[model samples]
Target: MATFATSDQLLVIIDPAARQTDGESVRIVKDVLSAGAAAKVCLPEGPEEFARALGRRGSRRPVVVGDDRALVRAVTLLHRHRELAGCALSVVPVGSTLALAQSLGVPTSAVAAARTVLDGVERRLDLLVDDSDGVVLGALDIPPAPVRAAAVAEPVSAASGRPWLRTTYRSLVRTLAPRPPRLAAVPAPGPCRLRVEVDGATVVDLDQPVEAVSVTPGSSGAAEVEVRPLSVGAEATPLRASGRTVTVVGGDFRYRADALVSGPVRRRTWTVSEAAWALTLPAHP
Candidate 1:
C-alpha cells in the first residue's frame, strides 16, 4: 500500500480532445483551479507529450482536465511506470464521452469538477491488470460490440455543370419521397466455447458454449466474474464468482476494456490489485 498527502500545488494537464471539444469549459476549469491553488498547467498536443508532461509531474498533485480516455491514459501511464501506488489523481471531465467518469462519481459540470479537484478526498480504488500489461479502470466485456459501417456519400465531379442543382434535387427527392422501409437481416452472434477459470478452479469448460462473459473489479479486494452460457431454448443462469484472478481461454476472441477494444488472442488472464490506485472524489458528508 502507498500513502498520499493532500497538497495545494498541482500540475494540471489539459488534454487536446477536451480543448477541441469545449474550449470554454477547459478555460473555466483552468481559471478555477489556478485561482484555488498554486497550479502549473500544460497543454499537450498529443499522447507522447501528454505522457511526458505526466512523467515529470514531480511532487505536485496531478490533475487531468479531459474525458474518461484521458483519465485512463494517465492511470495506465502511471501504472506502467509503477508510480501509481503513490499518486492520487484528479479529473475535471470536459468531453462528450464521460460515462466512466460519471460512473466513478466525478462531477460532470466543469465548475463542480474543478472544485472537487481542489477540495475532494482521495479514495483508493481497485484495478484490473491483464497478462499483456493492459489496464482496465472500469469494466471488461467479451465479444465487443460490432462496429457499424459508415455510409459513403456520392462524389460530385467539378466538370459537371450545375452540381448544386443536382445536389438540391437529390436532397429534395430524399426529403419528400416516402421510401419503403428496408429491414436489415443481420444475425446475432453465436456462442463461444471458452474455458473460464477463477483462482485455479474451473467455472466453465470448453464443451459448453457461452453467450457472453464480463469481468469487473470488485470493491472487496477481488474481481467479480460472470459467465452466461448459451442454451438451446431457455436462458442459462449466469455463473458468478469472485476471486483475485480470472482466466479465459478459447479461439481468437475480441474484448472491450473500458472504451478501447483489444485482443483476438487465444488466452488472457486478469488479476485484481487490491487498492491499486487512488482517485479524488467529493468529500464524504
Candidate 2:
C-alpha cells in the first residue's frame, strides 16, 4: 500500500445517490479515508446542502464520493468560486458508471481509489469555458436534424413482443402479397445554418449549411473544431480547425456537452483554458 505524508486534512463529500445505491462502497471509502487522514465527512441530501458544505469546507482537501455527474458538480462549483486553480480535487468512484473519473486515470474500485486519495499525485488539465462561464471537461457535439429524426422514430420492444411479431408478419405479407406502387421520395430537411468561427477565422459562413459541429479540448492548449457538411450525391468532407477559441452563431441550436444537452441559443463561444484545474491521480510507474 502507498503511504501518504500523514495527517492530511480531507473533506469527504458523499453524494446522496452514492449512499442510496452502494452503502458498502460508501462505508469502505469513509473507512479508508478516515484511516489515512483527518477526514471530515459530509452527507448532503441535495445540491443546496452540497454547495453549503463545500463553501464551509475551510482549507481541507475536498474528496468526492460519487459518480461522474457528482464529480462534475463539485468541479463546476469550485470553478465558479474561483478556487479550482488552487485546489486539487480527488474522487472515489462509489456509484455505477464512473467512465469520466476512470478515463481521467482514477482507480474504479472503492479501496484502490480511496488509497489513491492518500497517495496520488496531482495533474493539471485544461477546460472549455463557454460564454456563459459554464465549463466542459469533455467533448461537445452538435448533430444534424436527420440524426435527431432517426432517434425519434426508433421503435422500442413492447411487453407482448408485438414489435418483433409485427416485423415477422410484415415480411411474410410482403412475400405473399402483390407488388405495391412506388412512392416518390420526400425531400430531406435543410441543413443547419451556423456561422462557425475558430480563433476568429470563419469555417462555416451563414450561407454555408452544416450537418454537425463538434468541439473538444486538445492536449496542446487548443480546441479542436469540426464542421461536417450535409452530404450531396457522395460523401461530404468535414471542415476542421484548431485554435484557442471557437464561436458558433445560428438560430436557436442545441449541442451536447459531455452528458448534458445545452442551448437553443443564438450564440455560444468556447475558449480553451490551459491547466485551469488539477485532479489527484495515481502516479506512473
RMSD of each: 8.2, 10.0
Error of 1 at 96 (Å): 2.4
In the range 204-237, model 2's lDDT, one tens digit per residue, is: 9989778889898887699989898878889789
Per-residue lDDT of candidate 1, residues 19-71 (tens digit):
98888899999999988888899999999999999999998999999988899
Error of 1 at 224 (Å): 0.6
lDDT of 1: 0.89
Off by over 4 Å in 1: 1-6, 147-189
Sliding window of 10 residues with minimal summed lDDT for model 2:
146-155
For each candidate in turn, the TM-score is 0.83, 0.77
Cα lDDT for residue 115, candidate 2: 92
Reference-based lDDT, residue 112, model 1: 97
Q: List the residue pairs that clash in candidate 2.
A: none
